[model samples]
Target chain A: MQDQVRSNVVEILTQAIPSLESKDSFALAALSDRAIELAAVFHDEDALGIALVTYAFGKLVSRGGEEKPLAPMILLLQTAVNALSSDDNSAYKKSIQRLTRHIQMVDNKINLYFQEILEKARIKKGSKLFESGFSIAAVASLLGISQWELARYVGNTTVQETQPLHTLSVGKRLKIARGLFT
Target chain B: MKTLVFDSGPIISLTGNNLLWILEPLRDAFHGTFLIPRSVYYEIVEHPLVMKRFKFEAYQVRQQLEIGVLTLIDDAKVAKLGDELLLLANNIFSSRGQPLRICQRGEMEALAVSILKNASAVVMDERITRTVVEQPASLQKILRHRFHNAISMNATAAQKIVTTCKNISIIRSVELATIAYERGLLDKYLSRKSSAEERSSLLDSVLWAVKLHGAAVSEDEINEILRIEK
Candidate 1:
């Protein structure tokens, strides 16, 4: 992992650990956003793992996962933070994987819901990357989403309207195109 | 030979709108080659061929390639220049002291081919790549808006890309549809005795279709096109 990504992971995990303890939905939501920011900026798998786990935790807290079930998930997050702090990449990866698996084991319903969240997050972040000046094809490839999905998402957004128009007018471009084709 | 290089977005947009069939007629009209770089081929066809959801779209694009409506260009020079441009583009912007990796090879490769072939224009619907080629300042503003942070630019790299791609023209699938409409190629879809209202409706529908399917065209632009056509 890049040092920047590592520092970001550690920072987010440090904030997330306490938020998980008190079932603070607001903080978790913020942390989830930060994790996603890191995921989008770095396009790193570790950042993506942290994002997925953060989102899953947010969902659990919002839906009222019991304290007992949430305890182990928090511990796994701590382990992830410790692993990163100690510069142990292997341990960090294991903790992230275990964290995800633990979430899935929490309940069958939440497991299904987590899958939905994962897909939605991918699409959302993919669209953000597109908005941030990545090509649709590149963003789709990075997030493992489809151009169809990214395009549909982008079309609905104000991306087209917000973009600075090319200096060439529509009339001029149409004329140039007409000349070419004719 | 007259040529137009294509990135994957326009092809995907056209395919999504069931307008892939228009390409053959347009190419016939242009009397030029329509080329897609290798990475674009993988994005639109090869990679999607294995995915159940997009397999049909992949096959539709593949059919165009097999029938000579589209050709693939994959050479070391294109690949090398593409990698160079990819590096330059991804490094053009930085936030928090880390450069953002914003572009992928598919679009870069297509752009590289366009620069090398000196093609008429690159047919693409994704706004970012077009912005990079046409207006780097706008891209800087876009990144600033999206990230809301201290975004910085490598002016040298930005200038390099601008100079490298200065002559390249870009058109989208929306334009292709419009050109097809003007050429009366889309007339077959209209009734035998279509009125002006019906023709306007056809134009509006096709324009919106490309927008909804992922061409980076706005409602105002579509309306403007309608007004101009009128």
Candidate 2:
């Protein structure tokens, strides 16, 4: 079952990307997908990762004159849906919150993509309308945004600020520096 | 879909830089798993000082092959990785019965684990990674004979990945990028961007970041910092 899906995704992406993008652009998607898939089987996050890679890839690709379909984009979009509306993944709703900023980050040039993400993030049944702690910085970085631009568009008031635990002591810091594991 | 193998380096870089969030896409991109070697797990979780931050007793990185933290590891498979690692790093690293090669044993085990686990690629952030050093003798042979390799990264690739990663995380925004600099995430970059007097202010900011991101001074933040110098 997974094999069929994998082959199908590769085939579709290969054919469709070429049709919509330049050779280099399509190749980037193809290569990235290939890498993501290999990473996927190693762990299980490949599909969603592909969706996300697609999300980010699409934005980058589009900017490079590549066009993407709303159909396939839905897969990555739906992962967020599953997070919000699905019952099986209830406990993981918090993790699902990640979709909010990613959606905001991607589809930046495209309004529809933003809407899709906002809907999922906002509509989780019974979820409080607020996770006031979500950081725009965290979101922006995850989405491959440039800090210079982020500082401008994301305001301090509307954009949540320095809320998450952000400290590491000297002792812990040195351990990372002493990366030598002998 | 390029396959990326996880070694402690990328994970640490990502985690430190607040790029761990990419694990979301990464986990999703890979269909929800993060693969690593079992020996690697012992290495990551067993550190005495490491306990100060990532409490292994509590958090298991949830992935397809949850080796140590949240998921179960396939022991037989892990041992298989250990075996293959022995071959990959044979001269320098011996898995069994060598007191001097303990670290090599650990590293080889990671490589083998990556291969046996069907990983598309193996990754490591060790100081002596695939680049910036001569290839391991055996791997040199493999690159020569197998693998039709256009996948190598040069500085451009590094910059691209870094830039792309930063954008995805929204850390690349001017405000955040500046904030990152202020926080010492991009120390040298911040310093260079500043006037000579601003350098002092920037250094002061670094001290602030030492306080701000204490345990959280992730690699992305660091990258933002280094970009200043670059």
Candidate 3:
């Protein structure tokens, strides 16, 4: 069962890859890394991680390039629903319900381990996020780290060496600083 | 005056344990400044505010800001210093081919602030950042002892990290709490209904929770602290 679901996820992500932009693919890869690590840690053969990964991938793909249906992602979701429903093409409503519930359970577990997995993933993916043009604070939040934790990674990241973007200006920070201290 | 820069984790750890109250007396007796970098502010304040569960803690931290217990250290000099340190530190890590992002912008900012202000110490609860700053050797020690790494590094690269991280003093929230404990600030917060022994256990419990939340206190260290003659 795990092998079946893993194959399904690999097929779906590979098919969707062509349609994705670079950063989207990069984010997908991060999610894939997380799923693989979780699978290894839990020694899970049931592909619970894959189901969660696919659902997360679907969400990321859907979030990109607004308005359009993201046809590949829709197709992927439909394929997952069909696979999850055990070939019951007729039970459209019931299959949708099962898919939703399964995705939810996977989501819950993903969030449960988010702090643990993302802490490790930050080593590789932090630079990826920076290279993909996320600001220090943005990447830090995405990785579930404090800006202090993310700062050290930013130095090693492959971000384009432009002037570092300011979330708060020096003058503004000082004003707030003085107000707090005085 | 000597300065102590705080990272978000220690703030969260202190506040989570309902021990933010200790900072006031800690500051009074220490006769130093408590600085919060802008990036740490974003983590403990701006980002967490969006989450329902952390909004209260965020609010409490904000109150500290307003009352002058925690001062924000955002300015041109500090920001520029922070950027330089970020590049320098990260370069050292990647140079070793480890590519481990051992510190974040806020931690870098904290270090930069400590350096620029001629501060006394960087108060942080994070083990990785502390190891990178005060003891790069410990990074290899931890990796070998705890996490078995297959990759190896050249001696020159390791030396670079050590040189770059020199002269940075690292302290943890546990130490600040210890200060508060000695000053009798912790006793004020303890339950009067409990006996002296129970109160001591309660203090240990607080230390245990902070350690669990990344206070840089090892289990052995915490056990020793608990067994200390009080």
Q: Look at candidate 2 and tell me the lDDT of residue A98.
A: 48
Which segments of candidate 3 are over 4 A away from where they belong?
Answer: A1-182, B92-98, B141-149, B152-161, B189-196
On residues B1-230, what C-alpha lDDT tens digit does candidate 1 reach at each position? 99999998888888888889999989998899999999988888998798897899999999999999999998999999999998988888998888888778888998999999999998988777777777776777777876778889999998999999998998888888999899887898899999999999999999998888888888888988999998
Q: i-RMS values of the candidates, in order?
A: 1.6, 19.9, 14.2
Question: What's the TM-score of every candidate structure?
Answer: 0.92, 0.29, 0.59
Question: Which lDDT tens digits does candidate 3 get at residues B1-230?
Answer: 76778877688778877888777766666577788989888878887788774788889999988888889988888788777766655443321133434355776788778878877667765555554554455344333322233324344555654565566666667666655665566776677687868767866877776755445455545555555525
Worst 10 residues of 2 chain A by lDDT: A125-134
Q: Judged by lDDT against the true structure, how good is candidate 1?
A: 0.84
Return the TM-scores of chain A for each candidate in numbered order.
0.84, 0.24, 0.31
**Of the true contacts between chains A and B, what fraction does model 2 have?**
0.00
Which is the winner by TM-score between candidate 2 and candidate 3? Answer: 3
Candidates 1 and 3, the one with greater DockQ? 1
lDDT of each: 0.84, 0.35, 0.55
When superposed on Cα atoms, how far off is each prediction in RMSD?
Answer: 2.3, 22.5, 13.6
Q: List the residue pairs that clash in candidate 1.
A: none
Which ten contiguous residues of candidate 3 chain B have the minimum total lDDT?
B142-151
lDDT of 1 by residue, A34-144 (tens): 776776677787887777677767766887878878898889989999999999999999998898888767778777877887777677766666776677877887777
